[model samples]
Target: MFWTGPLVTALILQFISLGGGQNNDPDVLLESSFPPAEPSLMNLNAICLHGSGRARYPASFFPPSGYAYARRAGKAVNRLEAWFSQCCYEEGAKGHGQILCCAKQAWEAALSHFCTEEFSTMTMAHECCQQRGEDRWNCFAKQAPNPSYQSLPGYLAPEVPPDRIVFTWDPYTC
Candidate 1:
Protein backbone atom coordinates (compact mmCIF):
# COMPACT_ATOMS: atom_id res chain seq x y z
CA MET A 1 0.00 0.00 0.00
CA PHE A 2 2.83 2.37 0.79
CA TRP A 3 4.25 1.88 -2.71
CA THR A 4 0.97 2.55 -4.46
CA GLY A 5 1.08 6.33 -4.46
CA PRO A 6 4.36 6.76 -6.29
CA LEU A 7 3.46 4.08 -8.79
CA VAL A 8 0.10 5.68 -9.50
CA THR A 9 1.71 9.08 -9.96
CA ALA A 10 4.20 7.62 -12.38
CA LEU A 11 1.40 6.00 -14.35
CA ILE A 12 -0.67 9.15 -14.45
CA LEU A 13 2.27 11.18 -15.73
CA GLN A 14 2.88 8.62 -18.43
CA PHE A 15 -0.78 8.52 -19.40
CA ILE A 16 -0.96 12.27 -19.89
CA SER A 17 2.29 12.35 -21.82
CA LEU A 18 1.08 9.70 -24.25
CA GLY A 19 -2.11 11.64 -24.92
CA GLY A 20 -4.67 8.85 -24.75
CA GLY A 21 -6.67 10.05 -27.76
CA GLN A 22 -9.45 11.38 -25.47
CA ASN A 23 -11.20 8.17 -24.48
CA ASN A 24 -9.96 7.37 -27.94
CA ASP A 25 -11.87 10.41 -29.15
CA PRO A 26 -10.20 11.96 -32.19
CA ASP A 27 -11.62 15.40 -31.43
CA VAL A 28 -9.63 16.00 -28.23
CA LEU A 29 -6.95 18.66 -28.32
CA LEU A 30 -3.42 17.39 -28.25
CA GLU A 31 -2.08 17.70 -24.73
CA SER A 32 1.50 17.72 -25.81
CA SER A 33 0.98 19.46 -29.15
CA PHE A 34 2.81 16.71 -30.99
CA PRO A 35 1.56 15.97 -34.48
CA PRO A 36 0.02 12.60 -35.27
CA ALA A 37 1.29 10.37 -38.03
CA GLU A 38 -0.72 9.68 -41.16
CA PRO A 39 0.31 6.38 -42.68
CA SER A 40 2.30 4.62 -39.95
CA LEU A 41 0.00 1.97 -38.63
CA MET A 42 2.61 0.62 -36.26
CA ASN A 43 2.99 4.05 -34.71
CA LEU A 44 -0.74 4.24 -34.32
CA ASN A 45 -0.90 0.82 -32.71
CA ALA A 46 1.91 1.78 -30.42
CA ILE A 47 0.01 4.85 -29.28
CA CYS A 48 -3.22 2.98 -28.85
CA LEU A 49 -1.65 0.11 -26.97
CA HIS A 50 0.10 2.49 -24.64
CA GLY A 51 -3.21 4.17 -23.88
CA SER A 52 -5.24 1.00 -23.70
CA GLY A 53 -2.82 -0.78 -21.45
CA ARG A 54 -2.66 2.20 -19.16
CA ALA A 55 -6.41 2.50 -19.10
CA ARG A 56 -6.99 -1.15 -18.42
CA TYR A 57 -4.07 -1.99 -16.13
CA PRO A 58 -3.75 0.87 -13.72
CA ALA A 59 -2.79 -1.32 -10.83
CA SER A 60 -1.13 -0.17 -7.61
CA PHE A 61 2.20 -1.80 -8.23
CA PHE A 62 2.66 -0.89 -11.86
CA PRO A 63 2.68 2.73 -12.89
CA PRO A 64 -0.92 3.75 -13.65
CA SER A 65 0.22 5.24 -16.96
CA GLY A 66 3.51 5.54 -18.75
CA TYR A 67 4.72 5.84 -22.31
CA ALA A 68 8.16 4.82 -21.15
CA TYR A 69 7.17 1.38 -19.98
CA ALA A 70 4.17 1.00 -22.26
CA ARG A 71 6.04 2.27 -25.30
CA ARG A 72 8.99 0.08 -24.49
CA ALA A 73 6.82 -3.00 -24.19
CA GLY A 74 4.77 -2.01 -27.23
CA LYS A 75 7.85 -1.51 -29.41
CA ALA A 76 9.23 -4.85 -28.36
CA VAL A 77 5.96 -6.54 -29.26
CA ASN A 78 5.77 -4.57 -32.54
CA ARG A 79 9.31 -5.46 -33.53
CA LEU A 80 8.68 -9.11 -32.86
CA GLU A 81 5.48 -9.01 -34.93
CA ALA A 82 7.16 -7.10 -37.74
CA TRP A 83 9.96 -9.62 -37.86
CA PHE A 84 7.50 -12.50 -38.11
CA SER A 85 5.50 -10.64 -40.75
CA GLN A 86 8.67 -9.99 -42.69
CA CYS A 87 9.36 -13.70 -42.73
CA CYS A 88 5.97 -14.30 -44.35
CA TYR A 89 6.48 -11.46 -46.79
CA GLU A 90 9.85 -12.86 -47.73
CA GLU A 91 8.36 -16.27 -48.23
CA GLY A 92 6.00 -14.66 -50.71
CA ALA A 93 8.64 -12.42 -52.26
CA LYS A 94 10.89 -15.23 -53.32
CA GLY A 95 10.24 -18.77 -52.13
CA HIS A 96 10.70 -20.82 -48.99
CA GLY A 97 14.37 -20.79 -47.86
CA GLN A 98 15.22 -18.15 -50.48
CA ILE A 99 14.93 -15.20 -48.08
CA LEU A 100 17.55 -16.26 -45.60
CA CYS A 101 18.10 -12.62 -44.77
CA CYS A 102 14.51 -12.14 -43.71
CA ALA A 103 14.58 -15.31 -41.70
CA LYS A 104 17.69 -14.11 -39.94
CA GLN A 105 16.06 -10.74 -39.31
CA ALA A 106 13.06 -12.48 -37.84
CA TRP A 107 15.12 -14.61 -35.51
CA GLU A 108 17.27 -11.70 -34.43
CA ALA A 109 14.27 -9.46 -33.89
CA ALA A 110 12.64 -12.16 -31.82
CA LEU A 111 15.78 -12.51 -29.74
CA SER A 112 15.94 -8.77 -29.24
CA HIS A 113 12.33 -8.69 -28.22
CA PHE A 114 12.90 -11.41 -25.66
CA CYS A 115 15.95 -9.63 -24.36
CA THR A 116 14.09 -6.46 -23.44
CA GLU A 117 14.39 -5.56 -19.73
CA GLU A 118 10.76 -6.39 -19.08
CA PHE A 119 10.88 -9.88 -20.49
CA SER A 120 14.48 -11.08 -20.30
CA THR A 121 14.21 -13.07 -17.13
CA MET A 122 10.90 -14.54 -18.14
CA THR A 123 12.24 -15.52 -21.55
CA MET A 124 15.12 -17.18 -19.82
CA ALA A 125 12.66 -18.95 -17.58
CA HIS A 126 10.65 -20.21 -20.51
CA GLU A 127 13.37 -22.25 -22.11
CA CYS A 128 11.14 -23.41 -24.95
CA CYS A 129 9.67 -20.07 -26.06
CA GLN A 130 11.58 -18.58 -28.97
CA GLN A 131 11.40 -14.97 -30.00
CA ARG A 132 9.69 -16.33 -33.14
CA GLY A 133 8.24 -19.62 -34.25
CA GLU A 134 4.78 -21.16 -34.05
CA ASP A 135 4.58 -21.80 -30.32
CA ARG A 136 6.57 -18.85 -29.11
CA TRP A 137 3.80 -16.88 -27.45
CA ASN A 138 2.28 -20.03 -26.07
CA CYS A 139 5.58 -21.10 -24.60
CA PHE A 140 6.05 -17.72 -22.97
CA ALA A 141 2.60 -17.98 -21.48
CA LYS A 142 3.60 -21.19 -19.80
CA GLN A 143 6.52 -19.48 -18.09
CA ALA A 144 4.51 -16.81 -16.31
CA PRO A 145 5.33 -16.80 -12.57
CA ASN A 146 3.42 -17.05 -9.28
CA PRO A 147 1.66 -13.78 -8.52
CA SER A 148 0.73 -13.39 -12.15
CA TYR A 149 -1.19 -16.64 -11.96
CA GLN A 150 -2.80 -15.91 -8.59
CA SER A 151 -6.06 -14.58 -10.08
CA LEU A 152 -5.99 -11.73 -7.60
CA PRO A 153 -8.06 -8.58 -7.89
CA GLY A 154 -5.68 -6.41 -9.92
CA TYR A 155 -3.29 -8.90 -11.40
CA LEU A 156 -2.99 -8.99 -15.18
CA ALA A 157 -2.71 -12.33 -16.88
CA PRO A 158 -0.42 -13.25 -19.71
CA GLU A 159 -3.57 -13.93 -21.67
CA VAL A 160 -4.70 -10.56 -22.96
CA PRO A 161 -8.23 -10.13 -24.22
CA PRO A 162 -8.86 -10.14 -27.96
CA ASP A 163 -6.91 -13.37 -28.34
CA ARG A 164 -5.61 -12.04 -31.65
CA ILE A 165 -3.91 -9.26 -29.69
CA VAL A 166 -0.84 -11.21 -28.73
CA PHE A 167 1.99 -9.75 -26.72
CA THR A 168 5.67 -10.59 -26.38
CA TRP A 169 5.82 -9.50 -22.74
CA ASP A 170 6.15 -11.54 -19.58
CA PRO A 171 3.46 -10.96 -16.98
CA TYR A 172 4.14 -7.99 -14.74
CA THR A 173 6.18 -9.27 -11.79
CA CYS A 174 5.04 -6.74 -9.25
Candidate 2:
Protein backbone atom coordinates (compact mmCIF):
# COMPACT_ATOMS: atom_id res chain seq x y z
CA MET A 1 0.00 0.00 0.00
CA PHE A 2 3.05 2.28 0.33
CA TRP A 3 2.75 4.10 3.64
CA THR A 4 4.09 7.66 3.34
CA GLY A 5 7.24 7.80 5.40
CA PRO A 6 10.27 5.55 5.80
CA LEU A 7 9.81 3.90 2.43
CA VAL A 8 10.57 7.03 0.45
CA THR A 9 13.13 8.63 2.75
CA ALA A 10 15.01 5.40 2.93
CA LEU A 11 14.60 4.76 -0.77
CA ILE A 12 16.13 8.13 -1.60
CA LEU A 13 19.10 7.50 0.66
CA GLN A 14 19.28 3.84 -0.19
CA PHE A 15 19.04 4.35 -3.94
CA ILE A 16 22.04 6.62 -3.80
CA SER A 17 23.91 3.95 -1.91
CA LEU A 18 22.59 1.32 -4.33
CA GLY A 19 19.69 3.68 -3.99
CA GLY A 20 14.53 6.11 -3.12
CA GLY A 21 10.14 8.71 -2.49
CA GLN A 22 6.03 12.63 -1.66
CA ASN A 23 2.91 14.39 -0.80
CA ASN A 24 0.99 16.82 1.45
CA ASP A 25 -2.39 17.35 3.11
CA PRO A 26 -2.37 15.95 6.61
CA ASP A 27 -5.70 14.25 6.13
CA VAL A 28 -5.62 14.04 2.34
CA LEU A 29 -3.46 11.74 0.26
CA LEU A 30 -1.74 12.27 -3.04
CA GLU A 31 -1.89 8.55 -3.68
CA SER A 32 -5.64 8.59 -3.32
CA SER A 33 -5.75 11.47 -5.76
CA PHE A 34 -5.32 9.04 -8.64
CA PRO A 35 -5.92 5.43 -9.51
CA PRO A 36 -3.26 2.81 -9.05
CA ALA A 37 -1.29 1.55 -12.06
CA GLU A 38 1.36 -1.09 -12.26
CA PRO A 39 4.89 0.09 -13.06
CA SER A 40 5.12 -2.29 -16.03
CA LEU A 41 2.26 -0.52 -17.76
CA MET A 42 4.17 2.74 -17.15
CA ASN A 43 7.28 2.65 -19.34
CA LEU A 44 9.08 3.74 -16.17
CA ASN A 45 12.42 3.94 -17.94
CA ALA A 46 11.36 7.01 -19.85
CA ILE A 47 11.62 10.61 -18.80
CA CYS A 48 8.49 11.59 -20.68
CA LEU A 49 5.66 9.20 -21.48
CA HIS A 50 4.33 10.85 -24.62
CA GLY A 51 5.34 11.77 -28.17
CA SER A 52 8.75 10.80 -29.46
CA GLY A 53 9.63 11.34 -25.78
CA ARG A 54 12.87 12.76 -27.09
CA ALA A 55 14.81 15.01 -24.74
CA ARG A 56 18.30 14.84 -23.31
CA TYR A 57 20.42 16.89 -20.94
CA PRO A 58 23.95 17.76 -19.86
CA ALA A 59 25.71 16.99 -16.57
CA SER A 60 26.00 19.30 -13.48
CA PHE A 61 22.29 20.07 -13.60
CA PHE A 62 21.59 18.56 -10.17
CA PRO A 63 22.22 15.00 -11.09
CA PRO A 64 22.04 16.93 -14.33
CA SER A 65 18.34 17.69 -13.70
CA GLY A 66 17.23 14.56 -15.46
CA TYR A 67 15.82 11.19 -14.46
CA ALA A 68 18.42 10.81 -11.74
CA TYR A 69 17.25 14.06 -10.17
CA ALA A 70 15.75 11.95 -7.44
CA ARG A 71 16.00 8.22 -7.41
CA ARG A 72 16.19 8.19 -11.18
CA ALA A 73 13.19 10.48 -10.85
CA GLY A 74 10.97 7.61 -9.84
CA LYS A 75 8.26 9.71 -8.29
CA ALA A 76 7.82 11.61 -11.54
CA VAL A 77 7.07 8.36 -13.30
CA ASN A 78 4.96 7.20 -10.38
CA ARG A 79 2.63 10.15 -10.74
CA LEU A 80 2.50 9.77 -14.51
CA GLU A 81 1.69 6.11 -14.20
CA ALA A 82 -1.20 6.83 -11.88
CA TRP A 83 -2.47 9.53 -14.20
CA PHE A 84 -2.24 7.14 -17.14
CA SER A 85 -4.29 4.57 -15.31
CA GLN A 86 -6.82 7.17 -14.27
CA CYS A 87 -6.87 9.46 -17.29
CA CYS A 88 -5.75 7.45 -20.28
CA TYR A 89 -6.69 3.85 -19.61
CA GLU A 90 -9.38 4.05 -16.96
CA GLU A 91 -11.12 7.10 -18.35
CA GLY A 92 -10.32 5.88 -21.85
CA ALA A 93 -8.84 9.19 -22.85
CA LYS A 94 -6.58 7.53 -25.40
CA GLY A 95 -6.66 9.99 -28.21
CA HIS A 96 -3.47 11.85 -29.00
CA GLY A 97 -4.97 15.07 -27.74
CA GLN A 98 -6.30 13.57 -24.57
CA ILE A 99 -3.17 11.65 -23.69
CA LEU A 100 -0.88 14.48 -24.65
CA CYS A 101 -2.76 16.93 -22.49
CA CYS A 102 -2.84 14.46 -19.64
CA ALA A 103 0.87 13.77 -19.93
CA LYS A 104 1.72 17.47 -20.04
CA GLN A 105 -0.33 18.21 -16.97
CA ALA A 106 1.10 15.23 -15.18
CA TRP A 107 4.62 16.15 -16.20
CA GLU A 108 4.20 19.78 -15.24
CA ALA A 109 2.75 19.14 -11.84
CA ALA A 110 5.29 16.47 -11.00
CA LEU A 111 8.24 18.63 -12.02
CA SER A 112 6.80 21.72 -10.41
CA HIS A 113 6.57 19.95 -7.12
CA PHE A 114 10.07 18.63 -7.64
CA CYS A 115 11.32 22.11 -8.25
CA THR A 116 9.46 23.41 -5.23
CA GLU A 117 11.35 20.92 -3.12
CA GLU A 118 14.61 21.51 -4.96
CA PHE A 119 14.24 25.26 -4.52
CA SER A 120 14.00 24.93 -0.78
CA THR A 121 17.56 23.72 -0.15
CA MET A 122 19.59 25.18 -2.98
CA THR A 123 21.40 28.48 -2.66
CA MET A 124 20.52 28.79 -6.34
CA ALA A 125 17.74 26.65 -7.69
CA HIS A 126 18.25 24.58 -10.78
CA GLU A 127 17.81 26.58 -13.97
CA CYS A 128 14.62 24.72 -14.76
CA CYS A 129 13.23 25.64 -11.37
CA GLN A 130 13.81 29.25 -12.20
CA GLN A 131 11.24 29.07 -14.97
CA ARG A 132 7.47 29.39 -14.70
CA GLY A 133 4.56 28.06 -16.75
CA GLU A 134 5.47 26.73 -20.18
CA ASP A 135 9.09 27.68 -19.79
CA ARG A 136 9.63 25.27 -16.96
CA TRP A 137 7.77 22.50 -18.71
CA ASN A 138 9.78 23.09 -21.83
CA CYS A 139 13.03 22.97 -19.90
CA PHE A 140 12.06 19.71 -18.28
CA ALA A 141 10.78 18.42 -21.59
CA LYS A 142 14.20 19.03 -23.07
CA GLN A 143 15.76 16.71 -20.54
CA ALA A 144 13.45 13.78 -20.96
CA PRO A 145 15.30 10.47 -20.99
CA ASN A 146 14.24 7.26 -22.64
CA PRO A 147 11.58 9.46 -24.18
CA SER A 148 10.63 6.52 -26.34
CA TYR A 149 10.14 4.40 -23.20
CA GLN A 150 12.32 1.74 -24.70
CA SER A 151 14.11 -0.23 -22.07
CA LEU A 152 17.61 0.95 -21.38
CA PRO A 153 20.08 -1.87 -21.71
CA GLY A 154 20.89 -3.51 -18.38
CA TYR A 155 18.47 -1.17 -16.63
CA LEU A 156 15.51 -2.52 -14.70
CA ALA A 157 12.84 -0.63 -12.84
CA PRO A 158 12.83 -1.08 -9.10
CA GLU A 159 9.92 -2.61 -7.29
CA VAL A 160 8.15 -0.07 -5.07
CA PRO A 161 7.76 -1.52 -1.61
CA PRO A 162 5.99 0.17 1.30
CA ASP A 163 6.00 3.56 3.01
CA ARG A 164 6.39 6.90 1.23
CA ILE A 165 8.77 9.77 1.89
CA VAL A 166 6.86 12.78 3.15
CA PHE A 167 7.62 16.21 1.67
CA THR A 168 6.84 19.51 3.26
CA TRP A 169 5.15 20.67 0.05
CA ASP A 170 5.45 24.20 1.28
CA PRO A 171 5.76 26.85 -1.43
CA TYR A 172 9.43 27.65 -1.99
CA THR A 173 11.14 30.64 -3.52
CA CYS A 174 14.44 30.97 -5.39
Return the lDDT, model 2, position 60. 20
Off by over 4 Å in 1: 1-67, 90-108, 119-174
lDDT of 1 by residue, 1-174 (tens): 111333544444454345432243221211111111111222323322332232222222233454344333334334443433444442342533333334334434444444454454433322433345645544443332210111123322132223133323211211
In order, candidate lDDTs are 0.33, 0.39
Q: What pairs collide in candidate 1?
A: 11-64, 11-65
Model 1 lDDT at residue 15: 45
Clashes in predicted model 1:
2
Predicted model with the maximum TM-score: 2
Write down the TM-score for model 2. 0.46
Candidate 2's C-alpha lDDT? Answer: 0.39
RMSD of each: 15.9, 14.1
